[model samples]
Target chain A: MTNLMRGTELARDIVLRASEKAAGYTERTGRKPCLATVIVGDDPASVTYVRMKQNRSHKAGLESRHVALPEETTTGELVAKIRELSDDPEVHGILLQHPVPRHIDERAAFEAIAPHKDVDGVTMHSFAGMSFGHSEFVSCTPGGIIRLLDAYDVEITGKHAVVIGRSPILGKPAAMLLLARDATVTICHSKTAGLPEIVRTADIVVAAVGKPKFVQGDWIKPGAVVVDAGYNEGNVGDVDFDAVTDALITPVPGGVGPTTIAVLLEQTVDAAWRELDA
Target chain B: MTNLMRGTELARDIVLRASEKAAGYTERTGRKPCLATVIVGDDPASVTYVRMKQNRSHKAGLESRHVALPEETTTGELVAKIRELSDDPEVHGILLQHPVPRHIDERAAFEAIAPHKDVDGVTMHSFAGMSFGHSEFVSCTPGGIIRLLDAYDVEITGKHAVVIGRSPILGKPAAMLLLARDATVTICHSKTAGLPEIVRTADIVVAAVGKPKFVQGDWIKPGAVVVDAGYNEGNVGDVDFDAVTDALITPVPGGVGPTTIAVLLEQTVDAAWRELDA
Candidate 1:
């Protein structure tokens, strides 16, 4: 009997709950829960992602505002635009789509969003708050992963969990959340030696590296829970699913990707709740 | 045949060099490197530490401006005092002695000091900057440990380094710095299972668990360079010195402790340089 952690279904459930909450808030206060999407350049992948996010937000009964910039946009220009959105009361959640043009400093652009409206949790301030276990906006993918693990009744405390990647949004924040859960967390990246050997020791392995099938099936310990956060080319993931039959693993395309937008919408409703109280 | 890393001697050398640089800067710019020490109470240890730092600053030809507050001072009052120091042009480094009265929120106190003047590196901003591999004021002890390692020509890149502890000041930042150096870093805290077995795989071990002699010598891999960043009661460290014969370990009292002050002084001078340039 295979116990699959279905992300698309879970995401649908989450989006519906968020929509209900958002509708309740709108009824109480005449304003829809608003999310601002800041996109730079005409990158196809970025455009697709932002459009998907906006579609999801609209379906969740949240207002979606789009700010598109040209490819030649400067970091200062992007930062100014984000700051304007941050100051606007209508924008409850701000999503600065990643991989801004190479010339524009991405970190600087992300920092432009005010901490309160940083619903995507891409800012350093949000990162620090999350690491300190404070109640703040969390990185979307990691936050969604944590929700998935919780929904599955995965016992994280005292578990030997290993996170295979160190990206600011996904891997690092995931490790911090796991650490806060009383799990013994270890982060492995490009510099890591003996990758397969370390994977065999994990009670929970989070394969977040973008490389396809980096973690082999034989490397997974028996009964170990696996979270493949990678969305690589051709629907491949960081972990090789064919090799592992004894463990519970999230599917590549339908697992982490669907939850990203769900978490974003959930956070939008949360932001609205906080703003109403304020 | 002592191959041990002596932190005290190294720290003294660093302090001496900082003193010379401080003197030179004063001669060139007609102003001494000044560190403003803000203390909220007369906690004996705090007072002692402040006095020790002042003495060292004086010896290093740097000026120390002490801002002493009453024991009953509120968080707002303490923050205002810290802000005053932070804004003072005469002060290059702002050091808020920790463990401010029980009534005061110490984190707020740390936040009051601007990141540029945060030589002690206690603020979340400074922590994030250092963790992300930015050139910022690092936590004194961890900064000292890295300096000690580099001075000894210990190659960190592509090496297996295990850090024991998860404290903001040491363990987490140390792991980040090691990762920046291209070393595979693992942070094992109290919840870590079979820590000894994990440590055995490390080529470099940083014991910062705070418990005296918590890491056994048998757990240390042979010829691994050990940095004992812990200082507990009776001048004891996290590692059992008697248990390890093959590993090069840093002793308790003479190890990470002395280097803390050295790093503090160096960072003060660095802040002075930056402020003058600005």
Candidate 2:
């Protein structure tokens, strides 16, 4: 029987832990943990993502502060706004909705978020910390994938994990995290040759290329665990759901999405605790 | 006819360019490019390494400032000394000799070096920059490996490059650089299973496990280029030199050593230029 990797169930457990911690933190400190969500322009997808995060924050007993900037905001203006949030003592975490205006320098804006409060783990400092295995804030998608794997008691050490995609926030960080767990990790992209043959050799496969059904079932090894991090149009995923007879796999709609929000809330609470101590 | 990748010749070209650049900088600024070499104790190998770096600096028309801390120096003291060098306007680059006293926090010491002046690329900032495909200073060994590959005109794009080992300064950084160049990179370590089978698939193989003759030549694909970055005891390398027929390979003593120092000198000069501009 192939086990469905139910991200919703796993995410519930994590959210429960974070919620309890946040309650106690609020009770003791007389203030709730705060996450500031910043968005530039009104990209429909970005707007929905921010709303989902804010809703989840409320469910987790955390405070959500929303900032909406105009479409004409320049990179300098966006960075200045992020810096203001970074300096705000009440804000414990910051999440900048990605794909800001085409003219805005997204990297510069992300870098403006202070490293300690980078709950989304989009900055260079966060990437460096993850690469060095120091356990600082990890990009939410990759962190969720790890939590899903650990919940299933999957043994990562000595396994061969092939990751398809190299986006800084998703694919690249996922490979590094797998490597840190002692898994032999191979990162492939659109430029990679012999893609199917490479996927067949993996003990674990992570499909994050953002192309719906890009990875066929036949490419996966029997009994291999697969995590599909791609959420494309119509709620489709990179891996063809019907193609592979896998020992474990995450479903497209519910698999990775909920877990991402769970990790964000958990890290937000963690940031709050760290800040309180400081 | 198999081609031997000669580091000395490539390094000579690089050093000559750096020397000319350094001479011009000195004439313009009335001061030479300076590299500060810091050692924690009198380990013979460490001492010899520092002296070699100093000798190379002079040969390249750069000045070397050596700081030998006592064996009993604490991590705090070491960090303080490095910070002093970081703040010194004359010191354009800083090199912290590795394997400090067992109790000393080497990571902390490396972090103490200012990011712009981290010529050796041992700090976390340099590693992230390499991973993100932004050209900052790279760790010397990986920088040298890239230079050697470039010198030989090895085609890396879309190639399968397997790197053995994951040491922070060498293996990890080397894999990141290869990935940045568009190669599908697999990182293997002691925990990796079926290592030989994995190696046989590589179009390019980098042996950096520090175990002498650990990677047999039979594991190498025919016509594949091999780079042995390991300089094991007794002038041996991780790859068994006599065991495989390959298109190109780097010898143990001269393959990667000279190019590493060359990159150090070159980066020191580059750092001086950046600092002067700032």
Indicate the residue-level lDDT of A262 in model 2. 93
lDDT of 2 by residue, B24-114 (tens): 9999999999999999889988898899999999989999999999999999999999999999988999999988999998889999999
List interface RMSDs for the candidates, in order. 1.5, 0.6
Tell me how candidate 2 scores on lDDT: 0.93
Residue pairs whose backbone atoms clash in candidate 2 = none
DockQ (CA atoms), all models: 0.67, 0.89
Docking class of 1: medium
TM-score of the second chain, each candidate in turn, equals 0.94, 0.98
Task: Write the residue-wise lDDT of candidate 1 on B61-177 in tens digits.
Answer: 999998898899999988888888888889999998877788888878888989999899888878777767779899898888898899888998878889999887788888777
Candidate 2 deviant stretches above 4 angstroms:
none
Per-model TM-score, in order, reads 0.96, 0.99
Candidate 1, after superposition: displacement of residue A117 in Å?
1.0
User: Model 2 over residues A29-80: C-alpha lDDT tens digits?
Assistant: 9999999999999989999999999999999999999999999999999999
Model 1 pairs whose backbones collide: none
Best by DockQ: 2
